[model samples]
Target chain A: MIENEFYSQQNVGPYEYYQVGEFELEEGGVIPQLQLAYRTYGTLNEQKTNAILVPTWFSGTSKNYESYIGPGRALDENEYFIIVVNQIGNGVSTSPHNSGSPIAMEAFPHIRIGDDVRAQYVLVTEKFGITELALVVGGSMGAQQTYEWAVRYPDMVKRAAPIAGTAKNTVHDFLFTQTLIDAITSDPGFKGGRYTSHTEVADGLGRHADIWAVMGLSTEFYQQELWRLFGVESVEQFTQGFLRPLFQSLDPNSLLTMAWKWQRGDVSRHTDGDLAAALNRITAKVFVMPIDEDMFFPVRDCAREQALIPNSELKVIESRLGHFGLFGAEDSYFEQVDCYLRELLASP
Target chain B: MIENEFYSQQNVGPYEYYQVGEFELEEGGVIPQLQLAYRTYGTLNEQKTNAILVPTWFSGTSKNYESYIGPGRALDENEYFIIVVNQIGNGVSTSPHNSGSPIAMEAFPHIRIGDDVRAQYVLVTEKFGITELALVVGGSMGAQQTYEWAVRYPDMVKRAAPIAGTAKNTVHDFLFTQTLIDAITSDPGFKGGRYTSHTEVADGLGRHADIWAVMGLSTEFYQQELWRLFGVESVEQFTQGFLRPLFQSLDPNSLLTMAWKWQRGDVSRHTDGDLAAALNRITAKVFVMPIDEDMFFPVRDCAREQALIPNSELKVIESRLGHFGLFGAEDSYFEQVDCYLRELLASP
Candidate 1:
């Protein structure tokens, strides 16, 4: 076991798990014993029409979405049942660090966005007896899964909002993800992913964080010295104090697994590389939201995909924080996100 | 000795040297017995008024700028004395890999853009008895030096063109440069800058190349599949065949030395960090050219500084190649660059 405290169940907060035995993947492999770690807010209505699915983003857990679910928030736990599911390989779930034996660590099977959606489908239907979802919403890689859900099971999701992500990953993003993978694997301390502790690859993790410092935030964010908003005095302090510790706490193998899947995210594979055909199957009302300054999934890239999907509108969110604006770096971020979600849910 | 053949004198072609013993750097260090490697085309006129100075960019030697100099071209070497100087730490000159002991390899002294400009000034004034330069032009780091020369020796340079570079390095660019530094240093094969051969750090060099694949070229280049022009069918081949070999051939320590200087490139240090005051010192007729899609030094950043120069015009070059367009990847790239140079050189 990697023995990383950050991923331990105790540290990840309270969450329930449903064992999914012998889960076969889209890429020709089996995760012998699979589990979907998740959390639920509020009670299911008698009609079960108010149940919403909220998938976690890259490196995020069910706990990460807790702020969005509250008594009077857009999710509104008092009115709707919100199910926040942890995407596979995100430490809190059945990830490389936690899985034992042949599947543990670097030996973990490759996971696709479709695989995560399919697994969540089983849990949503078989475990809770929920046949339909009021809405399906997520950001970044989680948004990737949201698109997979809309394309794969359109009838089940009444509305979909994919934020700061695209239906198909761009070649540019694929190359960027490769750099992230290279940053981790190049470290000798990685030991071919057999390292017993996360600290062994601290230098690599710091480098990874340094890359994010460049691309994760917008150029304007750095130009305006937005790190001051985080109460950091210098750029070094922001990188070392904020970004480094955040990444170093995670397992390198788990991060690599997510990066691989993130690079290969293409819902069009469901329709033999025909993106228009795959998206046409989606009957759910869709709002394709991309951050204005997001370098990863630029607004133009998202708007192009939005045009292919029927009944879809391009919603451009203003954020100097760029792709990382999904973290609600500014109070305005949540305000805009909540306003959009409320409108999506209220539609016929 | 690293024994990297890519940077050997034989491989870099014939070049002349000017020795300036015990050269002091702007950043509190001395490079003992400093020799500047350079090449000159055409003969100096009796009055020495037709002399043009061209400086090399990061990882570039005097040979890299040959394409821009020829008969009937903008440079018109037959009619002008063109002095192409290899910037320090560019392997051909007094660099980390070639400079033995004392202040060699990892112990090499820090170099500033001002240091390179000062050394080139000495060579032009003392070695050639050239008191005036008709024009000074360069791209990327070469552009940085062009700005430094115009600002530092405003009286000597009559015309200047800085293409695809900034006068002051942005915080965003500083962070991006850090990622490049981290990519090389993170590899265990780096051995704390004591690796005997370049191959020892092949993994790190590959990672460094991977980062370039993401940022060196514009996103439009990838989206439009422009790699096909290079005769490569896939992104992997473009990265592995073209980019990897290009960077892996250089000395890691030399690249590191250049990167550190590149990150801290600021002419404003001459005027206590007042960019406007520094740029106002330029008496030359200046043309500031920025590629349309350059991710590293965006047009807006360049435009802001161009406004600070009293007699400068912003010339936006169209290139799907982005920052690397300075390499003249497309025939049209040379056409626009030549046109601009001709116009600038013809100016009073």
Candidate 2:
């Protein structure tokens, strides 16, 4: 039972767990026993074929995906059983902070995007006995897992929408991810991931969030004074009150684990570095959506990967919100997304 | 007297000093005794009209300006008395690191680009007895001071080239600058600017450099593996060996001082936020050169500010080198700049 307010399911709920025993990672690491936390809205139809899978992004929980989960939304849970699966190392799931002594903290071997996909596959096939997915969708790191599911188990996924993330981590993305990890571990208080209190690295966490403030969002986000839209008086207030405090409150080791996985995200890893061949493995009717203003995963980068997937369509979300556009920042963007997703889900 | 290798002229030199006594800052802080470090190549003509002023960029020294200075370069010191003035907070100058007690470290007063320009004005007019400048040129934060010189003392600056920087810090630039400052201070070892050794904040410094690895240059730097041009096997090698070590060696407080100045760089502040009014104040033949691929100073953003300057010509340096193109990364870019400078300076 995780007691940490920051990690507990009680804080951001509708969360449940599925036990996937003796999970083995693609990187040759093993978790003796594992539990994957997830949240579901709506009910599984008698066919069980109407279930849609939604995965969380870096530092994002199930609630982050619920922005469009309403009667008439893109992820209208009323129409389908939508399961928001929490990625491993995202605190709510089995993470470095809450795992047992043998597999806790530094002992928590590196997890990869493939490992998360594999775990989710097991939960869906064994626990829910769902043989096919109506749709699999996510953004950012969630998009990474979405790509993994499509390529790794193409037969199980009929449709896929990987938004604002690439099939392979670019050299730039790797560098960005490295910077975040280094920021956390560089803290003297980190103690090689054995720190007594997570807050000891609060400054490092705050710095990590500060980076997101610059790159995670678009230049127009600040220029348009969108901070005021979020009910903040100034950029300083938005940064200090929201961004910094949110990251600073999380477990540093958990963040590191997620970053490590984020860096090694390469769908081509199993296909001998041939990204095209890996992408060709996808049988899913794919909707490759990327935000135009995203600094990390620019539309140019995503478009290249989308072109490689034989059964894919590229949809660009035009917004000044950058990567955060996936968070439903603008109603027009959401409307565009809802229209596209509706067509994607309804298609044969 | 400053023996710290990081702050000492011995490490990066060919520098001299012009003592500008009791310098008063635009922010109302006064340095009891201010010494502006500078390096001069070539000779001041009998006419005292061939002097060129070049201010250093953030974390740069006089030596950085030497890259484009030689017999037949854009900044050919042979034709002009090129004075590379070290921005005040850069370690060699009267920075937080080398400044005397009471006003040292955290106590060092906030600095602005205008203050640096003011000090340079004193060095040019009072110390060297130079009445006018042949040119004033620099990139990044160096460009900031160039803009300040043109706007603040228009008659003294006959010609100016502010490359890869803006007349005013954009909202994105301010956010980026704030991240760098917060990244350093968030280190618990910072001790609120009273650290025993600079390396105590090495992690922060390294993270700071890592940021530049992303925004400082173009995406092509990674895509084309241009790091090979710098003789590094991988981008990681360039970052770990060169970038990180370079910044980690510098004094944290000194970096903070420069960053503080960089963020507050706005020529319009004196013109009551009328950027066009401030640009109109420049009588100098201005060449506002921004790199095509520069992320921080995009061509679009720079073009807007360039259009506002009444007597300005916008020369966009088209190169895949991004902001670093100003550092002579591409020969074609340098040729364009050299051709433009030759034309600008030779005009009767």
Candidate 3:
């Protein structure tokens, strides 16, 4: 495993790990001795009805949810027990990078969105003896897992919010994800995913950042010169100083593992490719929240699935930040997100 | 210089060359001995008023405009003398790949849209003894040159049509072009633009194709599975069989050269970055044609520039093909383009 301070437990954690031994993957592979890294805010109530499960997104860990958890926020730690679970292959969790010898690096098993939810199920029910979750909320890949949680364990999730992500990955998104994978593997220094350090594949990671600069943010962001908001004078400075270091800090294999799962995030597989049938299984009060400018998961795609769910509402968040708006670059983004999420949680 | 049949004179051409002994660039460089590859259809009349100049776009030769030519079409050979000029660094012309050493490959001087217009100016005024053009039209980078021709020598161009491109390349587009350059240079086999052949950087070329698959085509194109229109069974086949071979056939250094020029295509440079003042200088009757779904040159961007031109109308072409619709992939795309060109040609 390539050691990096960015995702190191010591650097970004006040978290804990839950052991999941010999976990079987959805795609016919075994991740022997699976370990899940998670963080919790507040305490589980005597009825265990106040538990809220928040899954981490691609390249994110449990700590990433800290911004949303505060006294007066929708996910107020004082009112509800918010358990933030890092998705599999997200570095802090048992991933390609830290999985040790035999199943390490490129040899790591291909993960699916279903595999992540199934494992999180064990942590929620077995560890905490929780019978139900007050809410399940997340964005992007975490939103994919949120959809899986609502559909797979319908009765357990009372309220669900899948933000800026579709239940079925679009062919457009799958192709976009492929370019990210191609960017990394094309580097010679990657050494077929056996590189000693992330620095070795700097050029490839830089290319990855370049691709993100085009799609991750909205065109208006560039047109309006919004990078200046980040204190960068030029586009080059924004890309080089900000995006490059952020992605370069990640382990390429870990990213590849998440990307592979992200491309194949199809909840409809449970209902023989029938998306309507899969979404109809949800019993939760669902809010399908998509960012207006999100190229990755356009509002139209999200609305299509939202219409299929029996008890759901399509709540679009306005932002000029595109898919990365989930990072809450503008205060208005989080304000809208919190408003809608609070409404969903307060329902019944 | 890597020799490839894709851009070889005999393979894709029945074109001729014009030698401009020593050409000076707008951006402080010289092409020592510049040669412009051109193809002409029909003959110039005694009045020299039936002449139309068509410039090739990036990665295009004079042949790409063939679909819009011939009998009864807007550019009918019987009605007008049509001259198609391949832009600099597009391989068939004096480019990074074909330019002999001292300034070969990565050593090639940077080219601007103004440099291309100036070189073509010599061919039209000096070689053909033509003081005025009946029409100047093109798409994408060709569109860039069309705008430059109208702005730089306003009186020389009587009618101008720039389709699916902008007067000033957007900051969003500059960053998109960077990803394409980064994809090629990041390849270990590229060897800092010193590769032996095009085949040496196959991975990089493939990554370039991957990026195009995401941005070159519109979202609706992929959402509707339009790749099937190309007779490809899957997205992989469309990308591998169609897009990959299309890009892989060209030399990487040649592409980089065009990409660099493309990113800096700002005719506003003529008026100290005052876009409105630069556009207001145009005396030619102009048709600013932008594809409705074109992500690179969105309708808003084109409309913003068109509103500044004194005698221009913003004509939006509805296409699911996005910017690649300029290739005339569908019959409807060409039908719309022809109808508009016919209108522009018959104007008073």
Cα miss at B40, model 3 (Å)?
Answer: 1.8
* TM-score per model over all chains: 0.96, 0.94, 0.97
Candidate 1 lDDT over residue span B1-348, tens digit each: 567788766887678899967899988989988999999999999999999999998888888888899999999989899999999998888998888878778889899999999999999999999999999999999999999999999999999999999999999999898888888887778888888888888888888888888888887899899888788999879999999988998899999989998998999988999999999999999999999888889898999999999999999999988888888878888999999999999999
True contacts kept of 2: 0.71
Best by DockQ: 3
Ranked by DockQ from best down, the candidates are 3, 1, 2
Model 2 lDDT tens row, A1-348:
234687665677769888898988878879988899998888999889889999999988887877878887878878899889999999888998888867888889889999999999998989889999999999889999999999999899999999889889998888888878877887778889888788788877877888888888877788788877667898889888988998988888889999998888899987999999999999999999998888889888898899999888999888788888877868878887888798898778
State the C-alpha RMSD over the true interface residues for candidate 2, after superposing those residues: 1.6
1 versus 2: better TM-score goes to: 1
Tens digit of per-residue lDDT, candidate 1, span A196-232: 8989999888888888888888878888888887779
Question: For residues A1-348, what per-residue lDDT tens digits would candidate 3 score against the true structure?
Answer: 667788766777988999988899989989989999999999999999999999988877887778878999999999999999999999889998887877899899899999999999999999999989999999999999999999899999999999999899999899999898888887888999989888898888878888898999888888888888777898888999999988988889988999999999988999999999999999999999999988778898899899999999999999888988888778898899989989998898
- Give one digit per residue, the lDDT tens place, for model 3 in B108-147: 8899899899999999888888889999999999899999
Candidate 2 structure quality by residue, lDDT tens digits, B63-91: 77666789988678778888988999898
Question: What are the runs in model 1 whose C-alpha is more than 4 Å off?
Answer: A8-11
What DockQ does predicted model 3 obtain?
0.79
Q: Report the CA-based lDDT of candidate 3 relative to the real structure.
A: 0.90
